[model samples]
Target: MYQYDGFDQEFVRQRSAQFRDQVKRRLSGALSEAEFKPLRLMNGVYLELHAYLLRVAIPYGTLSSQQLKRLAMIGRKWDRGYGHFTTRQNIQFNWPKLEDIPDMLDSLAEVEMHAIQTSGACIRNVTADQFSGVAKDEIEDPRPWAEIIRQWSSLHPEFTFLPRKFKVSITGSSEDRAAIKVHDIGLALKKNDHGDIGFEVMVGGGQGRTPMLAQTIRDFLPKSEILPYLEAIMRVYNQFGRRDNKYKARIKILVHETGIEKLRSLVEAEYEALRASFIDLPQAEVSRIQNFFTAPPYQNLEDQEALLNQQAQQNTGFGQWLQANRTGHKQPGYAVVTISLKPIGGIPGDISSDQMDYVADLSERYGFGEIRVTHEQNLVLPDIRQDQLFDLYQDLVSQGLATANAGLISDIISCPGMDYCALATARSIPIAQALSRRFEDITSQQNIGPLKIKISGCINACGHHHVGHIGILGLERKGEEHYQLSLGGHAGFEASIGKIVGPSFKEHQIVDAVETVVQTYLDLRTEDEIFLDTYRRLGDTPFKEALYAAA
Candidate 1:
């Protein structure tokens, strides 16, 4: 994790002090709600349907035990007893009092964290692959670049107020765990024929009312030129992106209106013009940033495959969790342990303060004192030893966090929906909870194979429903909650948007409709075919017929 230097610390403390005064002025009737809206938003505070929501950025989804403990403390003291880990790998405290937010910000500053750019039409938190440095297949750790982006974009005067909010995601692995295709700017770190590292730049990808996969603008851009290239893109968008209507403000819209080739030309022209004066980061500065993310000291331990198999043979629950929650790490004896937040019948991505404390403790004890938040709404202990898997599983089980449902139907990705967001049309969490309970059987889920079921309360696509294998969008139809199901959406390397299967189903019928789709897949799939493979191979015809046959 990147530690905050003197300048970083002072910058955050000043922002906190400024926001504290702003809150005081608002409370003193010196500023109206309308007058204070943008200010509050700039500080990552939102006035939701029920109360204020505070979103704290977890840069590249990395957190130290100390930072995690501080977040737990903030959740316990200032807001509700739990925080919602979002799709962007940030945490949201949904029930915070406006008056206490400044204090919360101050507390966060103490741990080198803040909520800046979390909300507002600015470059939000720069997300990266959760398993950045530890992934065995990574070309290079993307977090250093993510951190560089963070430093460059934070409070950049030119991009502080763009046409709309922008997001950038990077991944060093070929597997695309960061969902780069759906971001405003997506970068894939790769080595070219000459073995020099660079980025494959893609632009104009987003999900909302208009969902589109990002198109590659530059097949290969030197890693050293990322900042200036990004600046050029932002400059182009800032100059010509739609500003009259907030609906068509994202860079994705601009990319759609302006042809991709034309946009690329414009960006290239801008980049060439700016290259002379932009003064890119020196090699020394790059090294300084990279030093922060160097690998932790590892013991000369052998792989624990034999011990793990023996332990799994002894404990069924541990075995199930081991099969589902563990990812291969680059280190021989270590594994990346994903702690599923989406327990069956529980809210997705919501973690209690005590659970956070427990996870912090577990991370410090069993692994490196580091934790990571995934885009799929799960927490990770990135360097857990394989030999200590059973003990860690037992500890997670004690805290009710040992759900072996990673990438399963019950491991849903959903937003707060109508329960909190004023913009939502229907409740999302309830639908997720209902679907989770519907597929609560672990055996059934594993047998069904890897499936992503993303739900959104509205067209905003906060839950990333547009990319799920079985995407469900909750909507309001004639004063009743209804859901429209889509099939074959994927967020992997071969990213594609799902297609709507049929007419919307009422709330009562949605879960059953989903089950029908799943059963249809199970019935028609060949050997070892996952839901996505089946859907792609068979297309939407069979699923559509199955979903609406009776109707």
Candidate 2:
């Protein structure tokens, strides 16, 4: 994890102080609600359905033990005793009083964390692969680049107010864990034939009322020129992106309205013009940032294949968790462990303060003293030794964190819905809870295999429903809550938007409707075919027939 230097510390303190005064002014009646709106948003505060929501950025999803402990402390002291991890790799505290947020910001500053850029129409938190440095298939670690972008983009005067909010995601692995295709700017780190590292740049991917996968703008851009290239893209968007309507203000809309070829040419022209003037970080600073993400000290030990096999055979729960939650690591004796936040009938990403402290301790004891927040709303211990898997699993089980359902139907990604967000049309958490309970049987989920069910309360797509294998969107029809389903959406190397299956279902009928789709897949699928593969192979005809004909 990147440690904050004096300058970083000073900058955060100043921002916190400024926001403290701003909050005071608002509370004192010196500013009206309308006046305070933009000010509060700039500091990552939102006036939600019931209370103020404070969103804290976890840049590139990296956190040290100390930072995690501080977050736990903040949750315990200020708002409720829990925080909600979000799809953007951020954390949201939903019940904080307006007056207490300043203190909360000050507390976060003590741990080199802040709420900056977590909201507003500015560049938001930069996200990366949860297993960035440890993934076996990584060409190079992307964290250094992510950190570089964080420093460069934070409070950049030119991009502080763009046409709309922008997001950037990066991944170093051949497998697309970071969902790069759905970001405003997606960077894939790869090496060319000569073995020199660079980025494959894609632009205009997003999900909302309109969903589109990003298109590649540059096949190969030298790693050193990334900053200037990004600047060029932002300049183009800032100049020409729609500003009249908020719905069409995103860069994705600009790319849609202006053809990709024309946009690419404009960006190229801008890049050429800025090539002489744009000052990039020097090699020394780049190396300094890279040093922060070097691999932790690892011991050379044999793999624990035999021991793990023996233990899995002894306990079915352990066996299931081992198969689902563990991922391959670059080190011989290490594994990346994902702690699933979505337990059976539980909220998808809510973690209590105690659980946060427990995870911080486990990170230090079982692996490196670092934790990673995944885009899927899960926590990861990136450097856990393979030999200690059972012990860690037992600890996670005791804390109700070992849900053995990663990448399965039960491991749902859902937004807060009407429960928290004022923008939501219907309840999302209940839908997720019902779905999890519906498929509570571990055997059934495993049989289904590698299914992602993402649910969003509304078309804003906060839950990333557009990319789920089975996507659920909740909408209010007439006076009742209704849910719509989309099938075959994927957020991977072959990313594509899901298609609506049929007319929406009533709230009570949603669970049964989803079950019908699943059963249809199970009945028609060939050997070893997952829901997505079968759907792709045979389109949406069979699933539609099963869902509507039965209705």
All candidates' TM-scores?
0.99, 0.99
Q: Model 2 misses residue 439 by how many Å?
A: 0.3
Residue-wise lDDT of candidate 2 within 1-551, one digit each (tens)? 79889999999999999999999999999999999998899888999999999999999999998899998999999978999999999999999999999999999999999999888899999999999999999999999999999989898999988989999999999999999999999999999999999999999999999999999999899999999999999999999999999999999988889989999999999999999999888999999899998888999977899999999999999999999999999999889999999999999999999999999999999988999999899999999999899999999999999999999999999999999999999999999999999999998999999999999999999999999999999999887899999999999879999999989988899999999999999999999999999999999999998888755
**Can you write out model 1's per-residue Cα lDDT over 217-251, one digit (the tens) per residue?**
99999999999999999999999999999999999
Worst 10 residues of 1 by lDDT: 542-551
- Per-candidate Cα lDDT values, in order, are 0.94, 0.94
TM-score for predicted model 2 compared with the true structure = 0.99
User: What's the C-alpha lDDT at position 97 in model 1?
Assistant: 91
**RMSD in Å for all candidates:** 0.8, 0.8
Clashing pairs in 2: none
For model 1, the local distance difference test gives 0.94
